[model samples]
Target: MIIVIEPDSDVPIYEQICNQIMEGIARGQIKPGHSLPSVRVFASDLGVNMHTVNKSYHLLEKKGIITIVPKSGAVISSPQDFNESSFNRLKDEFKPLIAESLVVGMTHQQIQNLVTSIIEDFTKNQK
Candidate 1:
């Protein structure tokens, strides 16, 4: 999976890295048990600071999307790690985005359709 970072974007670099990693998981370009490159290597490859990649990995760990092991590296979390708390977290994360979409005048059907299309895109590569 390739992640393109926009230096001029309002979003922080670490957040962009985290978002792309999560999106890669959704698209099946990444999966459970796969090891991510070390923070230093990843940062060097992306031409970003090592601290930025470290922050992204830690945030993903906090979100239960990946696990960091000493001397091993970060690995994607398995589906079994998902639980009710994760579900609530997802809902909480969506609340603000949903509100913004509604505030922007997106109709219910439009929102539903958009979400469905995104889901399809994410699932398309799955077995």
Candidate 2:
């Protein structure tokens, strides 16, 4: 997956890297066990500091999204099984956004459609 970072954005470079990598995994552009480029090389290519890439990789690992292997670099992890706690966490995370949508006058169908479109983007490679 190609990572493009906006240097001028308020978001940190590491976060942008982390989010893009997560989206890549969600879209199946980077599959489980796929080895990511080494920190030094990735930093050079992105014109960012090596520490930035390292921070992003470590954050991904902390979130169970990737496994960093010594000498072999980082590898994407297989998706985790969803359970009750996961569902609750998701609901908690999305609650405010859904509430905000409602306050902004988005109908239930409109919100559903928006979510469906995002899910479709992630599942496009499933087929």
Tens-digit per-residue lDDT, 19-70, candidate 2? 9999988888888989999999999999999999999999888777889999
Candidate 1 per-residue C-alpha lDDT over 74-123 given as tens digits, one digit per residue, 9 for 90 to 100: 99999888899989999999999999999999999999999999999999
How many clashing residue pairs, candidate 2? Answer: 0
What overall lDDT, based on C-alpha atoms, would model 1 receive against the true structure?
0.95
- Per-candidate clash tally: 0, 0
Task: Report the C-alpha displacement of residue 115, candidate 1, in angstroms.
Answer: 0.5
lDDT of each: 0.95, 0.90
Error at 42, model 2, angstroms: 0.9
